[model samples]
Target: MKAAQTQLNRYGAGLAVDGAFGDGTDSKIRSFQSSHGLDADGIIGPDTWRALVTGSSGGGGGDSGLLTHAAAAGKFSAAGVTWASSGNCSNRNSTSCTSFDGLRQASADGAVTLRGASGCALTITGGTETGHASGTYSHWNGYKLDFAITSCLSNYVTGTFAYSGTRGDGAALYTAPSGNVYANEGNHWDVTFLN
Candidate 1:
């Protein structure tokens, strides 16, 4: 049961990972089964276990080269960024609303060919919450991230940054290869990877 919980959480169930197959875990299992075209019996039998472990469902592999939640939390430096708690904005509505993969991809884009001599870093300030009115739909699906440019090669602007044009201090919006949108939100950047 402990192993199952761990795997489910790792597979993006957003469960507590407490090693107990309580109601919450059972519900998540049923959802996973339904999505994967299984019997949806809320059972962790061989097939379900295999899917959870292998990420056979469409949700496991990142959109492109983005990192998984565990990978992002464990190896943020490799992605050329640092994680900071956004006060109440970190997990405003729920912790599960924040997409770790979205953060990883946004950070990767932010780090690309930095213009200034300083090492690039984006301090995450908001993710998946209602504290900010500007977020709206982007943050509602656990696919949006808000981060500020802590350090950069130059005074990063919306238009000059990679993957986007210009939107002044409002937002430099750019669509990624996977159709995810990244925007500049004044003091921070908002990434919406919901495709």
Candidate 2:
């Protein structure tokens, strides 16, 4: 239990590390499990332990939001959605440059179960380096993602995919098809994850 506490703390569980698996620890475990696409049963099994130690099982990058390709690939699955990438981007291949929060929001939005589509599907057209302002920008820090309207599920309409947060704490911006938030880049929606 002490080892678990220490490991969970290292993984940003924010527990006291008191060496006991009490209610607080259990709640934190469940939250972590849900964020990582685990069963969320609050039981420290081999899979949960592995996630806590390695930070690679699903979306288990902890609070840092660092995501590996393997982790990002499985994040949507964890959220019970199907997604694909449209182009080769440096952030998609890097182990330490992806945004777990952005991926998480994407997965959450993807799991909405669109009415007319076969299922909820999303296509990632841009990431970190692929979409950003020409000059000073936040994408260089691996906090942005771009999605294409054509690649999104047929049922998803611009301005219908709802999310919260502003540019300061990360936001979803739409362009070309409808509303605008930050910049109008054309035919794409940009989502910036929390820093």
Candidate 3:
């Protein structure tokens, strides 16, 4: 059997990845399973693994947010953060195939705010989690911002983001006479970038 913690982390859920199923990890796991519609057995299995990989079921991808995982699920400006986008058009080329950005957190509460910059006007990939006031943000410019926010004290917080993208117009244009391309199929929502 796998150490409970490993399974949880693998699924994109965040919880410190300590490799030990401690009380904190267990509670987090249960919360994650509950959010993802898992069994809540505090054990990682095939079904749970799938859910984790898909990032469609879980509590902020497990612990942190979506910006931390890419090949699986999951940007920036200021403080070394900037948004960037490239590749085939999506969102009418307003969002792009990928975007990069970052998030800022309130020191007192850890509530995070984010923004990004990119080249693509359309978005080929993007997603957002309306945290019960805490979660992450993924922009199609090849960027993801994560945090646990109950409330953002400031009107506009500041932070940084990094990003990149593939070369193609995405699924819609796959047959549109493009040399070679693919959409950002990755789930893009696994861990909370709280840290």
Candidate 4:
């Protein structure tokens, strides 16, 4: 069970790997099963275990080719990224703070790509903390991040990436070939980093 929890965390489920099959672990198991095309019955049976171990529905491959997991702010800083918050909070447990725990590695890599490509100073204003919309691939779930806007980033994202039209809130959208989505949210770019 501890291994299962660890594997789920590797897949960005964010469950505590304490070996306890609690509600959070159960929910993450069900979500992983559903996403991997197994039965979402919340049962850690053979099929689900296989999928969890291999990151695939069936057997054959070692991993699903999607590398993702939780990371800290220092990891981002080491990657040449910075963060800020309007409320000036830095605590991860605080809703008003900019948190990065459970932030998908792919998301951080995407930000690195953006910073390198744009040659701009990228400041992340939001992360896997609260205050964003709720969804399966939401900020709280580690799939999304919010980057503070700058003229250089604006020009690069708009000019370099392909425009995918505007979002529901009328924010201009851009998509990179790596399957990451960027929405212009006025003061920041709401980026959804996909694997």
lDDT values, one for every candidate = 0.53, 0.49, 0.32, 0.74
Q: Write the per-residue lDDT of candidate 3 for residues 51-109, one digit (tens) a residue.
A: 54554444453433333222121211111222223443222234333322222111101
lDDT value, candidate 1, whole model = 0.53
**Per-residue alpha-carbon lDDT of model 4 for 12-98, expressed as tens digits?**
555777999999888878776765556789998999888666655664455323322223453354345788876787655678888
Candidate 1 C-alpha lDDT tens digits along 1-195: 878877765434557767777898888787666644467898888888886675443344555434444434433332244556534323445553443533333433333222121345555555544544454345534456666654351244333435656556656676655565667665666666554
TM-score of each: 0.40, 0.40, 0.30, 0.62
| Angstrom error at residue 123, model 2 | 1.0
Residue pair clashes in candidate 2:
none
Best by lDDT: 4
Output the better candidate (1/3) by lDDT.
Answer: 1
Prediction 2 global C-alpha lDDT: 0.49
Model 2, span 63-171: residue lDDT tens: 3444444455444443333334443333534533333333443322222222123233455555544335543334545445555555343234444544334444344
What candidate 2 gets wrong by more than 4 Å, as runs, is: 1-63, 80-120, 134-137, 150-184
Whose TM-score is greatest here?
4
Looking at model 1, residue 152 earns an lDDT score of: 50
